[model samples]
Target: MRNSIARRSLLKKTLTGLGCAAVMLLSPLSLQIAHAAAPEKDELKLGFIKLTDMAPLAIAYEKGYFEDEGLYVTLEAQANWKVLLDRVITGELDGAHMLAGQPLGATIGFGTKADVVTAFSMDLNGNGITVSNAVWEEMKKHVPMENGKPVHPIKADALKPVIEQYKAQGKPFNLGMVFPVSTHNYELRYWLAAGGINPGYYAPAKGDIAGTLSADALLSVTPPPQMPSTMEAGTIDGYCVGEPWNQQAVFKGIGVPVITDYEIWKNNPEKVFGVSKAWAEANPETHKRLIKALIRAAMWLDENNNANRQEAVDILSRPEYVGADAKVIANSMTGTFEYEKGDKREVPDFNVFFRYNATYPYYSDAIWYLTQMRRWGQVGEAKPDSWYFDVAKQVYLPEIYKSAAAELVAEGKAKAEDFPPASDDGFRAPTNEFIDGLTYDGRQPNAYINQFKIGLKPDSLL
Candidate 1:
């Protein structure tokens, strides 16, 4: 493993030098208008989990966008997020569809200490929290109802009393999330915290990464595909996971989805197209080409107000891709998320791909993940606001995204208006668009951290 890493490091330096030389040779006008150089590595293997949000990658490959860039790409479905991220770090896969937190966490040495970065965010708002039928039945008594149906954007307060009941009976209330640093985990924690429930903390300084200190509810890791089965088998009472899995629970008649991450934070960033920094440095042109193809794929996914979503659903249902039943994937992919068996509602933004600049990886998105990491105890020490900015700048590469978008615009493939302005500082404007109604200004990360009622505030140790 050391030798392999050493080899990648050497190749990265060589490629970096070559890229710098090529840039130096170009005139200012040429630098401004030039398309990407020919790919250094064209035949690439990319990894993704069996989830509907991996649509951008599948669409890129299936629609020949990759081939259009003189690249031959193979898309493989990994067993889980760990396998997918590990394969990318090892160079076994050039890149992968990753959790938004994966690259940030890896860069900060949270779980795996590796320099991972993302230039393209795949999709947004594709996750939902679902509880087993037994839990939902108990929770429904406390949920506000209108016309014999549970209210939308159900709060975790409804589940809080149920957890208390389990505690009273001397039973542990277990909830599953995909990974510790996953959006699922943070979203679950956010929902629980919003309702005044203690979701626990991680004391990594003391080697307790379980995140269960002073906990009312215990959260654990379960891969996306196994969530429904895990809940059905009575291991976990509920789970927070990405598409098809949450919908799978409803289809299997084992669970009912309570709320979506959209309800938690509107238009929240979800999956990203991530590669090792070594791999990215070693394959700059190939990386840019890859982003271009994915950007095109994202445009296709959200074209004409999702007119092409049915086709996207068809492609994502193949055995090589998500491999779920088409109807199950379509339950959320095509715009309506089924909460209860028949309580489907129109959540048009439930799965956003290209619209709202979803593909542009903003620094604010990276900092949001870091804030959550700090809010929980994954980040053991408090850092200055500049530290958060520096870390986000390291992991989220909006410059590369702009390069890809510029190339597309030069080629008449995408419009300039569809992207953020060149003047965008990569920090989104502050807004109180959360289920808890607390404002988040990415520029003021510590203040945002302080706004939370249940998380560890600045300088607070577990």
Candidate 2:
């Protein structure tokens, strides 16, 4: 009987140990569940520039998506990209709709030395390059016309001779981009370089950040809302910017948009939702929840073949948001773009928010921006492929994005198929859809940079 009692005591201890092991196994899930609870901070303020691509932020606020996530968000419009980024860095704003390049630029000390991170990519492909009427009239002479209309995807080759004439007359062919590190600057530079015109360079190492060191066409900053008027006043001959400023130019008859960035680089990533790294770290749960709400907002924007775009346009027309006329904003927002007066074309993918996995913050997207920075001398030195990968990983938090997306899927707010494939390594397939017809694989940034006939070479420095 004593032996039987000892065996029973041993079995009891073994079962208790197994129970303890099970609890340890389940502990991680419990912690994750706790992290997904109510946000640490709910009432928030977000900033954005007054551009149509800022639609996702507006949609999230107006559609009650933030409220659904228990976030009371105040959406404010900053005067320009610089102020918006500065405000976020100073913690005056919780986050902001930022240039896809902003977080990368800030982190790398291009403009500001701040550790900023983006968990969400806002939208893609909503920008155009426009020239004043006189420049367009001059360019028309060189452009090939078919049946009384200039051919589509008007190459900057036609603009080359015009710049030459300006040089001949001792006139500076001045152009404008939104900011130094903006996509507008790079796209304008890319288009000009493709056509054999040197847009310029930046030598931060030499204390010359003007970016016009040896430029054939001088490029400078002009805020989006002022693009049309600046060109109209002859302060700038042309400008590259996002809508509805480009469309506003068409409506106001100040200039004509020659090429969309969609043509420059098809479906290119645009803006992102950026917060200071400190802010993100301090409020991890809030950041994830905010991303979830933004994802739902992006889905709503692109839903039903963009049947909701008109509503978005209406909402954006309010003075507090984009503040442009509804008609001008609709010119590009509703799947059509007016290039020249009376020349409307169907460009359904002109402003993609969610489709094509546009909302996913791909490392490939970040790498492409870094490549442009190096090509333009903003980086001032060549970096290895692994360096680009490291910077991209540091700025873009795909783990946070995935967790947010997973929650949406579990709650039936989104489908698993709607996101990047579970196996995606954050790199997009190589694409050659640029107007220059050169292929770019983010994995091979150096090779891609070397292919450019213009801009700084890997071995060449200012």
Candidate 3:
């Protein structure tokens, strides 16, 4: 088996090198435009958790997109988010897949004070909140039904009665999210708060980062892959996690996914490809090539309306990658999601990678995460709108993303129309697509934070 694997690996690398050579020979002008600068560092080790959104990294590695830009990347599966971030900070890993909020959170000294930054948004709308079988049984009683099946976008309102029952019985209602600064934590909080449940706050200023102060539902950290087994062991009643784990619950008959982040906030930013600011500055050419490779991978994932998702599922199922059954990964990756055991529904944008310009590192996306941090008290205090914008601009580097997209366009690997325009200003148009129906304008982040009913109020501290 070792010899066979080595032979195949050698063959794959040889073919990849030949492919790059062919591209250069066929289009010398394109090569000149794309590779104006040789990568500052050619070999890299990138980190990721075993989730589907890591697909871009996997696709780039597997599809030779990385080598196409003179990058040799080794994608490593991280034990958890903290370990992943720590490794990146220490320079043990060149970069890694990260939560959309991670770079911003680190920059603002929320969890760990580090100058992390991201030019590539890995994916969008790939997470769901799941409940244990018992919780789902009780929640079903309150959920609206259509034709004897549970209605879609099941709000946390249905979950409220169940929590009340737990409270009346004096049983502690516990839930799990991947990390405090993760999209999972914020989405779970957003959903609960929208339904009048206090998911609680983080008074990091007081050294109480537990985030469960006066909470109806106490949410703690559970790594993505462990979400299913951890809930099955009865340690957590439910969890909000990214793909394969949520579907794994359904496959194991242990839990039911209630609502995806897509319902909580449509096309919400999920993960990002992040590196330290020092690494990016020292290796600017290599950084752009990394982003260029990721951009190509994302385009392929969403190309032709996700025509390549099944193949992506196959790639992700490898033991070195997500290591989940293809069936479980496909449950969400193939344009549909399973709620109940058999209640699969069409949700084409469930795991978007490239569509809707998903790879663009928008400052509005960064500000939204910051708003969540402030709302949950992780930021500890209110600041001027200028502070939010400055933090966002510092962490989410749109200029790097645009430079990469420009390279791809020049090389004919992607189109000029495939990226945000030069005048995008890094903010998405103001949107009210949240579950609570509150408007959020990135330009007016403090105003957006004040509109929340269950979060920290203006000038309030825990």
For model 1, state the Cα shift of residue 117 in Å. 0.6
Which candidate has the top score in TM-score? 3
Q: Write the per-residue lDDT of candidate 3 for residues 57-162, one digit (tens) a residue.
A: 9889878888777777777889999999999999999999999888888999988899999999999899999999999999999999989999887899999999
Tens digits of per-residue lDDT for model 1, 356-433: 889999999999999999999999998899999999999999999999898899878988999999999999889899
lDDT of 2 at 255: 91
In angstroms, how far off is 375's CA in candidate 1? 0.6
Q: In model 2, where is the ten-residue run with the lowest total lDDT?
A: 1-10
lDDT of each residue in 364-412, candidate 2, tens digit only: 9999999999999999987888899999999998889999999899777
Candidate 1 residue 38 C-alpha distance from true site, Å: 1.1
The Cα local distance difference test for each model comes to 0.91, 0.91, 0.91
Model 2 misplaced regions, further than 4 Å? 1-36
Worst 10 residues of 3 by lDDT: 1-10
Estimate the overall C-alpha local distance difference test score of candidate 2: 0.91
- Please give the lDDT score at residue 98 for candidate 1: 95
Q: Give the TM-score of candidate 1.
A: 0.92
Error of 3 at 205 (Å): 1.6
* Candidate 3: stretches off by over 4 Å: 1-27, 30-35
